[model samples]
Target chain A: MMRVEEKLFQNRYRVDGARAHIEIVDGDVCAVHCQDKPCTFCCPAGCYAMDNGGRVTVITDGCLECGTCRVICGEHRNVRWEYPRGGYGILFKFG
Target chain B: MSEHFDAIVVGAGPAGNSAAYTLAKAGLKVLQIERGEYSGSKNVQGAILYSDALEKIMPDFRDDAPLERHVVEQRMWILDDESYIGGTYRSANFSKPPYNRYTIIRSQFDRWFSKKVRDAGALVVCETTVLDLHMDGRRVVGVRTDRDNGSVYADVVILADGVNSLLARKAGFHGELKPKDVALAVKEIHFLPEQTIEERFSVKGTEGVVIEMAGRITQGMVGTGFLYTNKESVTIGIGCLLSDFKKSGIAPYALLEQMKAHPAIRPLLDGGEMKEYTAHLIPEGGYNAIPAIYGDGWLMVGDAGMFVNAVHREGSNLAMTTGRIAAETIIDLKARGKPMTARHLAAYRKALDGTFVMKDMKKYRDVPAVMDKNRQFFTDYPHLVSQAARTILTVDGVDKKTKERAIRKEFARTRSTLGLFADAFKLWRAFE
Candidate 1:
């Protein structure tokens, strides 16, 4: 019945300032969010969520950084991907 | 001037963490470089962590590691369209202290292990991609990263990167991983209340079950499906050889959807909210697919060295074990003030051979090949067996002898006696 304690802080490497931001510009909508967005079903982290108007929004914070969205999102070129600044992404407890 | 350390490890997953932890704990200066923003950021698993290997590294890990459930039961099912024929093993002993295996979420586990590495005094850097190896005439003396001013020298470099290790390939340590040597796996984690998971799996708090399956699920491809009960969620996945998937023209997610809809599987996941879905590549090439493990001033561990034992669904454990062994080898060499040469580092290979990592891999080296070549095992045989079991078990007033004879006919109809015998022989050879 012993439980494993989760790690509190993880060390990461990332750009220092505004340059480290992952930007999604308005005109950069690479693919129109469809009624049945495949990313909603395929993304493991549920990072891609659809709104009432069916506009797909991506929250990169919860991203596991598995690259599934990047590879499977062939319909869109909007995912300007890069690793989060060193020490700031998903940290696995048991992986 | 080049900065030198006792060791530099690339990719801070299970392998890199293990090596770094071991070397640093032994008073050696170890630097671990990870491409992900942080360790475990890019990792995924239907993860069952074997305690034996991890215990070797962190003996009192159970006191600190974030484990979901200790697996007391394991079920292997052979599924047809609607029915399945499978066996289960459950033991109270498995639930006792020092449990054999535990289910884990990779994201949490890798973070914990990495923390242990840092606490052990290894300098760990993340979000740094190693562009290539820095060689001094066949001696790998350092790594050149993508970061500005990123070139760092070391006495040795251990490549613990996972399956898609471009560094090792670019360094000419191995060729491209053929589709046949890898499997594309897709998995989803369905979140349910803890009580629901226990009720569905017939276990109380902290007890867990793992179900492994093969059959019509893969659409006749050489592959398998799995469902593991975590504390409050279920990990369901299906994976097929990349080559088989490519040739069959089936998307990995489609296969996972089909598996979720399976009659025997659907009920367990009923009412569960689907939370996370992810896919990853598993290196299944076994012993033969292992590339050069050690070179001048360099070593390879984990998936980068093709250390997975696919037959047992074990990769992380192998990765950790190989990492530990590699670190041990380096520590021993350094203690003797020996140079990090390929000849000296061959101890890593010898240590691996003496461990279950090499032994288990060697034992099942032929399984993937055999299973790939024999489509019937994944398709026809499961259907026939499930049908026969259904027919025999259903009481339709048919004579018992008739039912028995019908089962025999089903088996014989699908495979000739010679074919059946060959399957048994192949299985034996694969496992022997």
Candidate 2:
């Protein structure tokens, strides 16, 4: 199995360390209402992961910004998604 | 201070670039905003450049467009777990000068196209995000950007934003896209030596091959896998509906690794170095899902408006065409000195309807629905067809008639005779 992290390592991204373009609007919705958190796995970049507390956590640094999490979080509408302030996200070397 | 222009084209991908290029060439003051570091930094595609579409925009594009290869052979394969039954159609005509299609690396290609837009007199702005539509009642008067005092007024606004068109959604142009409406695709570019690529795919210079497959690799999901030969890299990807991925709990990356591991596909990228992996969504909802294209002081183009013709694996062409046509419509309005009203902009729809874009879309409008419901087409047919091909091709002592019977019996047993006939009929209706 190819490590997705290694694959993402080959891509280029300029992280805005201060801002998160996307976040779960409510942690409770994810912790309680959301079961089978698809975002934890659906993200091609593996940006979303279950943390030690079993809550879905997202790190936007590795995001390719495909908007998979925003769309897939249809039930709760809990994912607040936005584009990183213009030059601050995934810069595909070979898009 | 607020900036004003005759037109504002948002998102500088193929559609936005095409629209801005055409509008600025006609001497309209156009402001094209892109969210990426540059125009193409956010775009991705399976990426076959249709010459006819670009030819309509810039007939001399082949001279310098960062093209990788001109496709000379097209292969369609149906894969089982280990085997694929396939066919190739290669022609000398495709290999000749003035080629039909070329595989493009979108980042380089879009950068080139965006430069052309800038050179054409449009004030192209990069690293700017359009935060919201500045509306006058129901009319989209301009856009509010994230920049300080970034409200840009325009006579007209063209939304050429790519697939995740949140601006349009936020404006209530269309409802949220259902998981069924889009397919999430992930791709990788595996770099190999130019000579190695030529030797492996059996082509030299600019000639390349494209292989498209549908089968068990999707794990009975409605999806396909593809490998395209670039100059020194191969673009390989697989995609299925978001719903399927959600339902099956199959990670798209895992699916790609499995596809790369397929026996028939492995050797082509056997020793290549994979450098970039990207993911994007393709609007597969066909014609039916196309939202309202024109509105008062506003118009939508490309993936934002769901203009992709998915059945034929044609999207970039439709994007460029729609972008060009939208620009042409606005230009006509300007010549006659008309307001950007819905009635006046409706001409864009009529013009698009007159082209092959709408005709082809109408032709296969049922495909997404048909293919979505019929999981067996992606699963059973690939296996049975590959089994049949292998059954007859093997050099064992089994007689030809006996082998044929064995294949027939296996098919009938797995999917009953009635099921097989229904599938044929469904295929005819869906594709025809």
**Which one is best on lDDT?**
2
- Clash totals, every prediction: 25, 0
Chain B TM-scores per candidate, in order, are: 0.98, 0.99
Query: Could you give candidate 2's per-residue lDDT for residues B1-432 as a string of tens digits?
Result: 376799999999899999999999999999999989998998898878999999999999988899999999999999999888889999989998899999999999999999999999999889999999989998999998889988999999999988888888898887888788889999999999999999999998999999998998899889888999999999999989888888889899999999999999999899999999999988889988888889999988899888887777899999999999999999999999999999999999999999998999999999999998888889888999999999999989989999999999999998999998999999999888
TM-score of 1: 0.84
Best by TM-score: 2
Interface RMSD of each: 8.5, 0.8
* Candidates' C-alpha lDDT: 0.79, 0.91
Misplaced by over 4 Å in model 1 are: A1-95
Task: Enumerate the candidates' DockQ scores in order.
Answer: 0.15, 0.83
DockQ class, candidate 2:
high
Q: Lowest summed lDDT over 10 consecutive residues: which window, candidate 2 chain B?
A: B304-313
Q: Any idea what lDDT model 1 has? A: 0.79
Q: Give, for candidate 1 chain B, the lowest lDDT window spanning 10 residues.
A: B245-254
Model 1: per-residue lDDT, tens digit, B1-432?
Answer: 256888999988888899999999999988899876568776777889999988999899998898999999999999999988999999999878878999998878888889999999999887776778898998998998867888899999999877767677777877667768878787777789999988888898789999999999999999999999888888898988776765675655567777888899999889987655566778898988999999999999998888888888999899999999999999999999999999999999999999899999988888888888889989888988888888878989999899888888778878977888898888888888
